[model samples]
Target: MIEQKVIINLTDENSNNLGTLTVSSIDCKNCNESRVRISNSLELINIPVVDSADNLTPIQYCPDIGANFANLMFLEETEYQILFESSDACASYDVLYSLTKLNENYFKQFRFSLGDNKTYKIAGTLNFRSYVGKSFLDIRKNKINSIKIPIEVRSKKMDYFNQYSSMIADLSHHALSLIFEVNSPLYQEFELDSKEKKTYYEDFMFLEYLFRNENLPSIFEYLSKNIHSQLKNRTEQVPLSLASNFNQNSLKNIVSKPNNLYKYDADFEIVHKLKGHIPQMIEQTKHDDTIDIPENRFVKYFFESIRDLIEKLLLSSDEGYIKDKLLFFSNEIEYYLSSNFFKQISPMDYVPFNSQILQKKEGYREIFKYFLMMEFSFRLSWDEINNQFKGFEKKLSELYEYWCYFRLLKVLNDLSITKVDFDDVFKVKKDNWSVSIKKGENSVKKFKFILYDNEIEVELFYNLRFSKNSKYESYSLAFKPDYTLLVKIGEHINYIHFDAKYRSELEIADYYNVFGKSDKKLNEEIDKRDSLEEKESIFKDGDIYKMHTYKDSILKTEGAYVLYPGNKTEQFFESDMIIPSVGAFSLTPGNDGVDENNLENFIREVLKTLLFKHGLINLNWKSLDK
Candidate 1:
C-alpha cells in the first residue's frame, strides 16, 4: 500500500489561518489496519463524531483514514480528500465541530497499511471553528503537486443559519421599502397641503369650483355658484386682503356677544329666556396630523410598531452575520424616523362638517392608507402578528402546497362524475399578519370541496390533524400530515397522503476520482458501488422512511407520497405489500403559474383509478386487483 500523511490546516470562520495539524502513521503489523499518531501538542483539540450513530466514515471523496475506521489507516504517498459519510444513515445531532486540546498521545488506526519512508501528503482546510462534534476527512488525489489544498467545510446548522438569514434580509428590505416610499394615499394626502400652500390662490379657485359641483352638500352651493361666479367675472386679480372688505362685527355680535347690551329689563328677561331655550351642542371632530387625532398617532405608532416587530424578530433569531444585517436595517429605520425630513411635516387636523366628508378628505384618507401599508409591512392584525417574520420564511413552501391543493380542487371541479361545490376560508386580520382560516368552523383550516350532486366530499387539509392517536393502533400520538387529500363517497373514506419535502437532497458522487481513486480500475469499482447503493438511496433516507411510517401507520391508507423539489417526474418504491412513492415536480415561484405537467399528469392518473372505482368511467379495473 502507498504511504500517506495528512496535514489539516485549521482556519477561522473568515478563512484566516489559525494553525496547521500534522499526524504521522504509526508502525503496525496488520496489512489491513492503518495506524497514525499525532505528535504535536498544539494540533487537534478534539475529534467529535457528529453523527448520532457514531460511525465517522469518510465520504466518497475522502480517504478511509484512521479517522473513519478504528482499525485502519491510509498511509499512502498520495493526495487525499476528507469528507464525512452521508448523514441519512445516522441519528441526527448538532452538526458543530469543536476545537479540542492538541496534545500528544493522539494515536489512530485504520484498516490499511503503508510502505516505509514514502512521503505522501494529504492536506485539507476546514473553515469555522465552533468545535462541538466530530470533523470528517475530505481529500482527493491529483497529478499536479500543489503546495496547499483548499476545501470548504460547512456544518448543517450553519447551512440552515445562512438560509434563514437570507430570508430575514429579504423581508426586512421589503418592509423598509414600503415604509419609505411616499406613493401610498396617506402620503399623497400629506403632500396635498404642501402643494396648496405653494399656490394658495390657484388652489382656492379650484376649491371654489369643486365646492360648486352638484356632488357637494347644499351648504357649499352659495359659495360655489354665487360667490365663485362673481369672483371669476372680475378679470382683475383680487387683493390679498380680500376678506377684510366683509364686515365680521355684526355676525360676532349676533353669535358671540349676544348679551353685550340689554335695552330694558324686559329685554334682559327675554334674552335670558331665549338663551335658556337654546340647546347646547358639542361637535366631536376627528382629524389626521393633529396632536389629539388617532390617525396622527400613526406616525410614531408606525415607527414603534415596526421597530418592535423587527427587534422581536432579531431577538428570536440566532446571533450571526444575518442578525447583524437586521440590526443595521433597524438602525436605518430609526434614522429615517428621527430625521429632519419626517419632523418638518405638520400633523393634519380637521373637523368634517358632513359625515361623509372624511372619506373625501385627501389627507384623512391618506392616513388610513398609510395605516394599511404599515400594517401589511409588519403583518400585524388586530391582536397579534401571528409570528409574521417566521411566516415569511414558510411563504415559498406554503405557496407550493396551496397551489397543489387548488390544482386538485380544479380537477375535482372538472370531473363529470359529481357536481362539485368548493368552499374555502381566507381571512386577514385588521392590520396584522394574523391572516388565517377561522379554525373549528366547518373545516375552516382545510379546503372543503363538496359534491352535493354526487354525494362525494373531498377535504384537502393543510398541516391539519389526521388523528390524535395512531391509525394502525390506539396509541395516543398526534399525526398531522402536510396535506391529507381525503375523498369520501357514500359510506367509505379513502385517504391519499402527501408531504412537501422542500430540501431533500440526492447524493453526488466523485466519478472523476479527485480524491485518491486515480486508478481507472479503482474508479470503476467505486462507481459500481455507488450505482448499487443508489437503489437503497433514491430519496433522502429520513424523508422516505417517514413516508413509509405514515403509510403503514395510517389505517386503510391507499398510498403515501412525497412531493420534493426536483426535475424528475416521479419515482415509485414498493415495500412489503405497501407501495409508497417519492415524486418530484418543479413547484417554484414565478410571475406565471406553476409548471404543472409533472404534477398534473400524476393527479390525472390517480383520478382515473378513482373514477373507475366509482363506476364513473367505462374502463375495466380487474388488473388493479392484482
Candidate 2:
C-alpha cells in the first residue's frame, strides 16, 4: 500500500489560521487515468487524472470517503483560504487545482507554482455565502499525482437538512394523502418483496406512517398488556417407571427387549440410548408455555426490518441533521427491540399470513395490518418528476417550488375553495398504473369560491410556461413562472404570478421608499444611503427583477410575487393601482408549524379585492361570511 501525507491549512478572512487537518491517501488502481463508457451511447471517453508530482507516479484518489468527509468542514456564508501541501510533491512540478460544487455544477480552476522552490503547494479562497453542500477539490500535477478531496459546507443559521426535509415531508404527505384518498390505481398492484425499484419516497412514506400512526408504541403497549403465549410440546428420555403418559409404546419397548431393561431405584427401567441420560430411560412427552409464537416473531421481524432500513438510510445520507434525525428514529426503534418480549421471540424468515390471532387480537391486529399495508402505501413513485428529484439529493429549488404550490393549495382549501376534480392534476399511466401529477403548463386545477351569492371560478397552475411561439402568447420572451393563479368573474379575468425563491433573505428599502413613493422621495432616500448602514442581503437582485418582468410582460397580470423563506413581507405598487403590483411574501417552513400567515392573508386580500372589483361582494362587508 502506497501511503502519502496530506496537510490542509484553513484560514479565515483576516489570515488567521482556523485549524489544520491531516489526511492520508489510500492506494487504488487506475488512479492516474481511467476510461468511462457512456451507458446511452456506448462511447469510451479517456479521463486523464491530473497529477501534482511526477508523471510516472501513480495517484491515490479516495472517492469512497463519502459525501461529508470529516476532514473538511465549512460554515455557510464564511470565506476561508485553504492551503494544500502533500509530501509526495516534486520540486519541478506545476500544480493545477480545481474546485467544483457538485450540486450547482460550479467549477473553478487555478494554477500554482512551486512553493519556495521546494514542495508543490496550492491555495484558494472558497466563499460559501450562497449555498451549502458537498464540493470536490482536485489537485493535479501534470501527469504525476492527483488527489480529490470532499468538502462539506453547512448552514450556520438553521438545520439545513431538517428544515428542507420537513418542508418536503409536509408537501409530500399532503400530495400523497390526496392520491390515496382518491383511490389512485397506483396501489392496485402491490408486491411486498419487490425491492429492485424502490425510492427514498417509499422509505420516507413508510417511516411517516409508522411515526404518524404511533404504531411502534401502540404495539409495545398492547403486547405488554395482552402477552400472547402458546403451549409447546417436547419429548425427552426418562425412566420407564416414572413416565406418566408413556403407556403402550414405553411398556412394549421395555418388555419385548430384555436388554432394554436395567436396574432402577426399585423397579426395572429401559436402558439409556444416548449420553447424559439416566441408566434406563423411556420416551416422555412434556408440555410448556412459550412466548415464541408466530405473532411475536412477526413483531420482532417488523422492528428488525425497520431498524435495518433506518440504518441504511443513515449511511446513505450526506446531511448531518438528517443523520441525527435518523439516529433518533433508530433509537426509538431500539426501544422496541430491547424489550424482553421481542428478545424471547426468534426471527422470522417470511411474513406470516393474517391468522386468527393477527386478525382478532387488538395489538397484533393493528401492527399486522400496518405491515401488510407498508408495501402498498408507498410503492407509488412520482412518475412525472425527474429521477434526480426523487432521492435524498433532491434539488432544494425544485422542492421549494413544489412545497409552495402545495402550501398555496392548502391555503386555498382552508379558505373554502372547493376543487373541481383531480383529473387534470393526477393521472395513472397506462403501462404500470403509476400515478403522475401533470407539471408545467399542461396541468391546471380549477376551484370554485362562493362569496355573497356570487360563484367565482379560480384556476391554479404549477410551473406555467409562457412561450413566444404560441398564438396567444402575451410575453415577447418565453418565461416560466413557478405558479400562476387566474380568477374569473363574468367577463373579467385577472392573473397573479408567483415565483418560489429558496432564499432566506431579500434586499429591500423601508416601506415608504418601496411602496407609494415618488421618484423624488426615492432619490432623496438613495442620497442618504451613505449615512445609513446597509443590511446584509443574501437574496439575489435578479429575483426581484424577474418578478417585475412577470408583472410587466404578462397580460392581465394583477400581481407578481416572490415567495421566500424570510421573516418579513413587502409589497410594491405601480402608481396607485392595486392590480399592478410586485411583492415578496415570507413563506417558510416552521420548526413548530408552517409560518404562512403572511402569504395566507395576502391571498385572502387578493381574493377579496377581485370579488369587490367584480361587483360580486358588497363593498361595505368587512370579511367574507365563511
What are the TM-scores, per candidate, against the unseen true structure? 0.38, 0.63
Candidate 1, poorest ten consecutive residues by summed lDDT: 227-236
**How well is each residue in 402-424 modelled by candidate 2, as lDDT tens digits?**
66777777766666557534455
Name model 1 segments beyond 4 Å from true. 1-294, 308-318, 335-341, 345-447, 459-483, 502-557, 571-582, 586-609, 617-626
The local distance difference test score of each candidate is 0.36, 0.58
Model 1: per-residue Cα lDDT over 440-534, one tens digit each: 22332323332323445566555656554533231345466666666666566667777765431221232233446558886687667544433
**RMSD per prediction, one decimal?**
19.9, 13.3
The clash numbers for all candidates, in the given order, read 57, 7
